[model samples]
Target: MAASLCYMNPTMIVTTSHRSSAELWRQAEEWAQRIGARAVRRQGSLAHLCELHEADGVLTITNDRLVYREPASGLEYFFHPGMAKVRIHNIEVGRGDPMIGAMQLRPGDGLLDCTVGRASDAVVAAYVAGPQGHILGLEKVPVIAQLTIHGLATYEDSSRKVTQLLRRIEVVQADYNDYLPACADDSFDTVYFDPVFHEPVEKSEPMKPLRELADKATVTAGALQQALRVARRSVVIKQRYGTPLWDQLGITQVLSSRSSRIEYGIAEP
Candidate 1:
């Protein structure tokens, strides 16, 4: 079967800024058209939008970028590579980053990020991969993908390298399950998966939104097999340190941060 576009609730209307220029409104309208959401003027409150459509959330477009706000939950989620603190810290530290160690990346290695999440890893991977390398990110959820894409596009950072790396990653809305099998053998230097772990680590507020929104598919042996077929060097899976994925996938080599709760399972050909 072909990959399906993940669903976004139609009740969530796209609202624009009150002082938005004509050009800005046009762009916002285009965004609404693409996402299949109605474009409306911002009224008294965002809560009004929720009541107007009886929606769970509202997607707002300002001069800066696109943002999704769920009033009831008070959860706001958007992606900006510059804002990925942990990944940035890892990059700053240079050598002991577990993800960098797991991928074993060279200067020009191409990577496939099967579960992009906030594209944090993908951004770091792209930085490691260099300008010559390419990265493709697959996100199964439409709303998440769009939000991420918008953030990637609009976020401005002082560091030109980080900005360039963010632009280099191509985020597509498609399930990796459907996309992987179609790839030719050794299509990318590394195929990376970061499925929702069976165990939860210490809770962080930023991660809560991801846990709620991300695809909760269990990674199986079959999934690893497909990833292995696509990876020229190795297939890596990131999860909680003690998850069953290590045993299930026969991943004996686990590289982890001494201080962090996460680990990476490497399956090489």
Candidate 2:
């Protein structure tokens, strides 16, 4: 399946939580400015705010976390490690992760995540990369990018190791299309792309909200070429099993797990 290019809804309003403090309001205003949205006072519920502002969604900045709410669907998106914690625990127990296997990551290696949605894979990659390695995640969507940046900086885990690894990831608000070309050859050990799956996974309820907010742009051949040029070892693409993207991109080296419907298509630079 091929993905069609789509962007975040422009009609989004940023507001503070109900009973918000002064600092939270200030932060909301700053976020609104950063994302090119209007900052409004929180009067009632998120749904009411959406109706009043005629916005497609409302981004509420609370003391604990940032929440993006779509009134129509009642979908709330926030930053969480999601399955990264489980993947990390699996790694700790000597279980293999398909993504880590595909990337062939090593300590001190540099990784560029071209489509770092919520930084879940990036967090897992960071854990495998260790202290000396670098993980840079590029996200084009404004609200999602900002939310990820904030989450990576603030979200904590029961394990100190996990918390530290999350902090190691660097989230950048830029599209890979513009960010990759300017890079020098062999800029990173690996470049990874996890575009929104063209076919939705029925069991992936957590991804539904993210899919709605993410950039639906599929990885173009030109972009893949740029990634190849930038990566020293290889470029990896993640897609649902049986996706035509593997053949369309001419990637023959594919990795998969018997338990997962996801597959990684790898191409060496």
> Which candidate comes out best when scored by TM-score?
2
Q: What would the per-residue lDDT of candidate 1 be over residues 141-237, giving only the tens digit for each residue? A: 6777887776677666677777777888888877888889989999999999988765667655557676666767767787788999999999999
Candidate 2 lDDT, 54-101, residue by residue in tens: 999888888877888888987889988889989988998998788999
Error of 2 at 72 (Å): 0.9
lDDT against the true structure, per candidate, is 0.78, 0.89
Q: Which pairs in model 2 have colliding backbones? A: none
Give candidate 2 misplaced runs (Cα > 4 Å): 1-5
Off by over 4 Å in 1: 1-11, 82-94
Clash pairs (backbone) in predicted model 1: none
- Lowest lDDT sum, 10 consecutive residues, model 1, at 1-10
